[model samples]
Target: MMAGMKFLSGKRSIFKVMGLICKKCALAIMVLALIAPFIATTQIILGDSKSDLEDAKKQQEDVQSKLEETKKYIEDLQGQVSDIQSYISSLDSQMETISSSLYELDLQVQDLEATIKTTEEELAKAEEDAKVQYEQMKLRIKFMYEHNDETYLGMLLNAEDMADLLSKAEYINQLSKYDREMLEKYKATIDYIAQTKADLEADKEELVNMQTNLQDQMSALSLLQSTKMTQLTNLNNTVAAEESYYSRLEAENEALEATTRQLEARIKAEEAAKSSVTSYDGGKFKWPTTSTRITSDYGDTDGRSAPHKGIDIGAVKVGVAGDPIYAAYDGKVVISTYSASAGNYIMIYHGDGLYTRYLHCSSLLVSVGDYVTKGQKIGLMGTTGNSTGVHLHFDVRLNGSYVSPWNYLSK
Candidate 1:
């Protein structure tokens, strides 16, 4: 009987121990319940990080699209860099914007990284706690399973009254619900962490691609700028040479005018003898150079002591040589010769006292007295005379006096 009484005493002790375990389990479940909302808040923050990354990508995409347009627009230069100053300014503007965008994006990425770091630490702690809570729950379940009958018997033996017994029973039932809920929460935390990690990695990769794309755009722009700079340098040199040419052009032109008048006297003598030019059909003169880009107009007097005598038509690419010079009208070549001031020149008489002269040819195609049709390729544009750059100096004379070529030019 004494041994039986000792056994009951031990059983009561076990009941007390089990009651303490149950209390600990309840505290763990309550802690999980409280922290559940915090984890949900963290999940929302993670979503916000994703949105910020996406927004940054969108901004870069916009800049990238504009760069593409710039790339295409730069291609329209067609071997010439004319009017390149304006385009260079445009490129500067675009680069400024791109630089600003990059700075802004970098700032945002830094902000996101800090935010993610803090949030990840919190999430990792929460996840570890949830795992611990789950482990505790499993241990409790195994203990209850191993001593299922004894656990309930201990509860009954330990209850002080009916109210207490019912309360303990209800508490045990609530623990099962806590177990299920805590398990779900733990799974959710793990999933959120995984998704956040994936998003971070993908965002990093996309940022790298954006950087590479920007580099390509910069390279293309640099190439275009280099080409334009070369053209600009050539143009500056040519302009200086042209200024020098104009300084001595007036004195040189006086003698040239005399000689040209003498040549015309001979041509008129031939026409009188029915040996040279036929009567003109009367039409606007053809543009004399393959390129209609005029470097100097007929009456351009800027930086010149006297008005420029003829239009100077340069190649499409400034300072480039070997482009064709064409005949202004159907005429007989009067004199095809080189002189100090008018190197490799041509004089054409288009009857009715109209005459066209081409100067600074690299090589003359027709001989003196050769009849040529209008728009014929008469020579290659060059800078052979009192000139220093490749171009054609075209003149129009009516009755031995220089006239405005613009008056006879169609365009």
Candidate 2:
């Protein structure tokens, strides 16, 4: 009877222990089921956040590219405008010269016309004098022919003495000689006047032709100036339109940047509130990308008016994208978002107010609130936002102020 009671008690105890173990297992399973949904929901939220961030980054990149192109076009237009203006100025100078030449030509033409008029008047006077002289010579010849010729010859023949005949002959000879000399002088004067008039007409014709040619040239220059003016106006209008577009793009970029900054701040605040602080190992940080080749050094000017804030790590080969970007140090992710200037980026918060940032990522491997380790891949390198090419931009900050990442990076 004692053995039987002992066996039953031991069996009862074993059953109770097994039942307790089964109950505990059921409770543990229930708890896991309850927590799994939350984890799934959190993952979904993070995924959505990443998607939104990516979209914003893509929009920003497109706008930035267009803005840059517009600015460049504006610059080109401005150069063309300057060239046109210079051409117009040159035309003005040419027109001034043409005008001066035209004025001189007019004076020359006027002077030539006056000279021709004077020559014509002189020719007319010479013609009249020749006509008058010819009339006088004709009258003298007629008188001699009708009366003196016959009568004087008869008287000469009728003269009985040699002295009388000689006297009559001398008189007739003098009269004839005078008439011939007067006729010759009138003929020479008429010929000279005709030649002078002809020469004057030829010179006047030449001057008129020259004036016509000058007028045609002036018309051509005027037409060219008009065409240039039209082109300049069109260029000015185009430049104005481009400038307006550029201004709109600039405003949009500023707004995007502002929104990104706000989102980052909000995310940082939320992460700080939710996450437990992580301590840095006080060791040197690892390189953030696969390649150690520095495309740009910290504090170096990146072709901007300002100095660069971070160092850029390029891929092994130029123009290659999709390289892994690793965390520089172990820390909790404080910000995983997109920015117009930084693109798809993440900020890790190491305790004691230290932080690190990665920029221009193509895709993110980690999310906000995630704890990352040094050398752990967090994203992929890309040419996002305002980036020029595929690379990783790494920065370090202490108390919100940027510092050189080189200070903590391993050699």
Winner by TM-score: 2
Model 2 lDDT per residue over 1-411, tens place: 332353355345435534543554465356446534532332111212334455555656766876776677677678867866886786677678768877887888788778878878887887787788778878877877789657877989898899988987898788789778767877787677778778877877887787777677667667666766876787688677668767867776676666555555555554572357755567899888879989899899757687877888888788888999888888888777786677898888877777888888999898887888888999988888778898888888776577888789995
Per-model root-mean-square deviation over C-alphas: 34.2, 32.8
Who wins the lDDT comparison?
2
**In terms of TM-score, how similar is model 1 to the real structure?**
0.40
**How do the predictions measure up, each by TM-score?**
0.40, 0.53
Global lDDT of each candidate: 0.67, 0.72
The Cα error of candidate 2 at residue 395, in Å, is: 37
For candidate 2, the 10 contiguous residues with the lowest summed lDDT are: 39-48
**Residue 344 CA displacement from its true place in model 1, Å:** 32
Model 1 alpha-carbon drift over 4 Å, by segment: 1-82, 200-208, 246-251, 254-411
